[model samples]
Target: MNIRKVLTAVLPVALLCLAATARAATIGVILPESYPSADQAKELQLGMTLALKTWPGDAAPKLVIKDSGCDARKADAISQEFIKAKVDVVLGNWCEINAGADALRAAGIPFISSNAERVKAQDLQLQMGRIELNAGEKIAADLRRQTGLRISARTSCWMDFDAALSERVDAVLCPVLTMDRGRWDQVANTYGAAFRKPFTASSARGYAAMEVALNYLRRAKAMKPAAALKETQATATLLGPVPAADAPAPTTALQLVFAPHLPKLNAQQTQTLDKLVKTKGCACPGGTLRNGCPRDSGPWGELPFVVRGGGTPAACAKAINILEL
Candidate 1:
């Protein structure tokens, strides 16, 4: 499918009118193969439904969900089918989804982008001139507020992967993104999301599957691609860090990281940290390491086999610092 074609297919026209006499609009939603995760998908679906419930007007947009399977080729075919079906709009739900939306656009249809990854944003806006996001920018701002910290390109599920934590020790804070694998699943289940009216989360915020299609379709009613993009940028709002209360806080938790290539520590401070490491695994104070300790040895090691899954560190939930060892 070409760009213009799919966009027009996906974005519903106002044909489903403000009149009760008119029919509803068809909004086709394309998503990642395993997107939003299983639980996340359901919650997102619920969130979209909730938004539609309060949408201002006499008509509601109908949702048709399908898994794109992360295949670019498949996405192209899907986009074409939606266009053939005369869909009002089609929204691509993952950051790396193919350029079929451009095909839809070229075909004179409006496409809604649901990608939130940095690479995706850069490629979309730079290449297609059709781009939107959810939390990518806000996360950057949040990262800037953090001083003396840098992120690891390494994608391991390390405890300190979030660039936000290097600023402090003792009492630590973590981003839920770290909970994607391992025992993190149970931990992440606690949080949820909701949106305000005008429903920026679906449209102006991150690219909402439905809103992207709708907004573009509505605007296409008047402007060209360049004008539509200008309008989108002018209007999009920050999506995540939702309401502080809506998303769950990282549970009272602590993790350790080595203070790499640092100045030598004083005797007394070093001694105190070393003491904690010996007695309490490695929860040393002031983010320093405990003296004479081996790596990856936490209090949970006492188990005959294992305990505190994922190799719990030696420090208490409220850790003091990394071990000098």
Candidate 2:
């Protein structure tokens, strides 16, 4: 073969191969820069980074990160940018995803979120599907049934732990996400070592979102991306699975109970206290003090704070007045 003829053929083939090798999926990430705190955003990014390191593919997806600033307009703008860039998928926290839902859907790009608010009628109108780990409404409904109380689901992205401590809320219901304690511990240890901080629920959610995105890409090879995600079964993750629409709601919830410190009582005093609690009746919405007073439901001063003098109804009545004073 002539030198020029052979060289031309080899170079074109090599270039094609190189181009194929360089081509990788693009994943757009929208994270808050300041709204929830810079530390939280960093934690989420670190979790995604950890997942990328464990990617089974020869070539990992390219990450295009944008600061959403937890603003709806900013998130929408970022979504438009991702659409222009032709990203295969988008991963975001609670603050940014809902704001960008329409744009991402129009672009035919899948979106995965770590948290979600109670689904509304408007949310149902969106064509693109969302894979959310924290389903607040479902969790709240389950808690209501279990506790026989009015449980309100959080509608905002801000932290609610402080609200739980306030006088206005009776109790805060938290869901236990980790299905495998052993696996969670392993991941948490690795995350701690890398970030120099304890692994948080947000971090776990971020890692799980990436895992789900990768799973979607794998399934997309055989089917459309939307269909693949829709057909995605319960994937074992640090936070259990991406709940199927028809899946049963979680039966358990962790309720953070708040109550005033009670005086230590002896065996006789304890027996007397129980009797008094049942007879006196708790002023809270839950009906009785057997489960402790939910101060949010009624005045704390109405609670029988002193059972010291005697377990009689009159003694409890007098104690209540003293507490009020």
Candidate 3:
């Protein structure tokens, strides 16, 4: 073992280590584990991991996953860890996003949400899945065709699967991710094999969101939060185009329409609803009534309203109206 032999081997090992470190990047993921629907968090992470496998390099982006528990406090704590480690990007479920959005924003970290309704355009908050929020009109139209009802005003059904509610309402619209039929079937098979359980729709969004995030990472010159956000919004994903940065929030309201005889609200309930409507003022876009449940009240009649099940049409049909607020 002479000095010359030792130097040659040490130099090669050092060069390899340097190259590996230079090419590697870190991505922080916040998922809700040990909380409601913990399995969803696991499934989502699996999807993200599977997508990362397709990255075009040997030096894959290193992932640091933290359990957010769907709580603001937990999410913030996990985000602090991400900040300390200087992660290149952060992605999470909507609950995690809602919990940690403020902290991540203040830290200048871009947060991509896999499932959530877009609340106005925030600089660091990017919504990725099923961004459309208002499906009231579409639900009503669907109801009309199915029940042959002259229904106009849209009422929200808390429990969409109830057969009784379905019989009464012209249609009950539930907000859900519309999966790509072909890819979903494939993913389902993969997920079943990987998890030893059935695949959920939320799992699909998790997979899609990660795929989109990776695409953005690949295209960006510098993986800074602002640059990533700009590039992602400007481009389209395999699923489709991301929403325009300047586009107004989605107006898709889920609704359950009733037949000709609208359900009547009790005196106290009616008063409460009326007050709620007054408080949520603008039933139209750009209105002053900030607290009111905005309603089309016009031919569209596609306002956002909620209906609860009861003994009869009166109890079952009663609804309270409001917007994202």
Candidate 4:
């Protein structure tokens, strides 16, 4: 065997492989430091890392993580750092992404947000990509047009009963988190094992953002990164299939009814409740008010509320309004 010749040939190939690995796409992730709690930020980071590990690729992209502290100035600084690093893509929560959006757009680096909040008009003009769970604004607009339900307040908190079920409001529009129970349980178990804590919606969101970034990179090999991202079809992610650019956003937001708001009914009132539940369908899967809400111990559980489902938000609003009246 020619040992010298073998070493010469193998060393070059090894160096080339290293070079290829080094050239893999760099992904920048900005997470909150103060507003949402440091533990949540850590969970988001862990979710991103897990996504990279599970990604079906020989060379995983590198990650450059920064803490925005939910501060605009800090977020802007982090964006500058990402720009200097020449990251192929960026992902972050709403605060950080919105604060640094202008700089990132100017840099021509594609960025995506996992925020479920309604996107601002300016952000839309900037062409910021978002994978959000809440479409409360859209739903509100739709309900307003269809049912003439007066919306008094909008909140992101799922358990904001005070605001959501206020006496002045006809209906509360809020985003709901939906996932395949089996798939979610599997992810939760794995995540809990790795982090020794319960998996959260934030964790799922972080994972989804990374998946989208990697997908964009994959498509960027053939076309422009922005176009690639824009063209990305619905992806079957941990949270579920993210809707394509033009596809109707998933049904995530629901109209909630404050159970306590309904006056104590006589036989006729009870009959009306039964008829409403039968025709409109109960928001609480536990059946109707007659059966009682089985799972009401969480946030809104403090006040006892029912979700209005199985019909349009406007219809739900009308029914609840009639019941209250």
Candidate 5:
């Protein structure tokens, strides 16, 4: 071959090699706790992995997953590692990432999250794309409408909101936490309490959202300001009933749902309770004697539930919308 021609071919090959090396992508994943009920963070990992499996390239992006403990401190640590590793993309789960979400944004990295807990709206990394589960709220709403159950200010703590449940359920669908004592629920249902285990989950869309985030990164091609904006928009608009939708700005924050174990008093129970109310002068001031007034031991072995709004089966389905960010 001519000397000039050989040099030209060699330069092209060298440039191609450099380009290939530079294009290698890196993906990091962060998850919250994984115990009973829904582990959205784990679901995110599974979704991302499934998508990575289908990627058609000899140099697939590095996939790294870390736990966030559903705690702000833990999320900060995981985010720090991701920063040091210089990951091209990240997807975090639950509310844990809220703490480090700002740092990531300052670093100009993009991330997708599945928790609706209130967080700084200005941060760019904190993209509220995937919802964890809106079905819980919907179920609560539907239950209220259909059952016409009289709700109490207190909600079931079996799915405690402060720790395990969300704090947005409305009247007749109060928030519950796991911290509630077992005796409480037992006491609540000594009679025909007709209690329903408030339902929540890692949910069906858990994995799919992660896949969406990964696919978004692959398609973005560049991480410039404009491209990041586009990705942010895409992530902000994720659709589904599970994980719920992000609360729109200026929109009232979703209200909490609280209902009694015996939300709807059986008709016979109501009539019996009502007679007791009238005979015992339930409306009377101070304590009245059981024989002549309202008493715990009634015709049936039932005690009036100690709660706000006592036993009025007023429908409360029409409550503020709860959008899970």
Candidate 6:
């Protein structure tokens, strides 16, 4: 071969090798440190680390974490910082994502979160949470069957329950994590041991978000900054595939869905229902309600629920019982 020709071929091959070897990308993570989600932030970091370890690759994404404090002002400021740094992709805001979402989108950076309710899904805003298809009707049916059923909407632990009920008339829906209590406890215990705090709903979600982000980067080939800004409408994650679409947010406030008539509940049963509401949440095999409410007895017998606005709690409970039937 001529010397000039040989040089051309060798140079191209060497450049290709160099590009392949230096394929690392940067990922920015913003967590609410000032407020309660500090622990969740730590757990999120842990989850990302675990995902990276599990998914072997030479071109690992570098995580650049920043604190998007609980306040909107702080979140906005942190977002500005991420923009200045020109991070490839952004993940964060365990709290009000509105603080940072607008700025990030304007800058064309991808922002992913487990807390879907905070920000409406938009151009570059992505949520890692899932939606329930038909929760309200089902709940009403169950309540009706068990007349005199004492039920209360306990939303303290359920994340997306209110959102689910939106499809129903005169009410919002909430979700109860019916996943296997045993497995969840085991996982929470492990996380607590590692992080020195009990694992929480936020933590599990943070972990799931990281896994989802990793999945997107891997599938989308966002190893370069330009590629990172390439917004994805939907991506598969550890929890499930999520799309950048408007999702329901969690609401502690409730709306009563009135039935034609109320199911009669004796005072004693009403008291039992009150007790169930005192501790809101559902206990099932898997942290999910794929099947109906797990059959049980006493305070736990019927599924725990909540009603709001219009009608008394006792009245609403009776109405729900009538609806369930």
Q: Best-fitting candidate, measured by lDDT?
A: 4
**What is the lDDT, from 0 to 100, of the residue 269 in candidate 5?**
41
Index of the highest-TM-score prediction:
2
The count of backbone overlaps in candidate 5 is 26
Query: What lDDT score goes with residue 183 in model 6?
Result: 50
Ranking by TM-score: 2, 4, 3, 6, 5, 1
Clashes of 6: 29
Candidate 4 least-lDDT 10 residues? 296-305
lDDT by residue for model 4 (1-325), tens: 9999999999999999988756888988778856657767777778787788878975899898888877778888888999999898888654443667789889888877665443443321122233233345554554345344454325434321223466666556554555667777887787888778778876776776787778778887888766676665445666666544433333223444433345444565455344433333334433324333323322222112235644543455455555455
TM-scores across all candidates? 0.43, 0.63, 0.60, 0.62, 0.50, 0.54
Model 2, 1-325: lDDT tens digits are 6999999889999999989756888889888867777877777788888888877875788888999888889988988999998888888644644778777777788877554432332221211123223554554465344433344545222331222433444333343343467878999998888778888766776787788877777776678876777755456666666655533333222222222333344565444334433243332323444344423332212321212233444444344332222
Query: Once superposed on the true structure, which residue ranges of model 6 sit more than 4 Å away at CA?
Result: 1-17, 116-118, 129-199, 222-240, 247-325
Give the per-residue lDDT digits (tens) of candidate 5, residues 1-325.
6999998989999999999766767777776645322444444444445446544544567777776665678778888899898887677645443566667777877766655433444444544422224433453444344434432333332122332223343243322211124533332343113223211223223333455555566555665733754554543212322222244321112223332223345565445434433332222223444434444434312221111222211212111111110
In angstroms, give how far residue 112 of model 2 lies from its true place. 0.9
Question: Could you tell me the lDDT of residue 213 within candidate 6?
Answer: 68
Every model: Cα RMSD to truth: 15.1, 10.2, 10.4, 9.1, 15.4, 10.7
Candidate 1 at 42: error in angstroms?
A: 2.1
lDDT of 1 by residue, 113-159 (tens): 54422224321121211222223233323322332223221222111
TM-score of 2: 0.63
lDDT of each: 0.40, 0.57, 0.55, 0.59, 0.44, 0.53
Off-target runs (Cα >4 Å) in candidate 3 are 1-21, 56-58, 129-173, 193-196, 221-224, 234-240, 249-325
Higher-TM-score candidate of 3 and 6: 3
Cα distance off (Å), candidate 1, residue 240: 7.1
* Clashing residue pairs for model 2: none
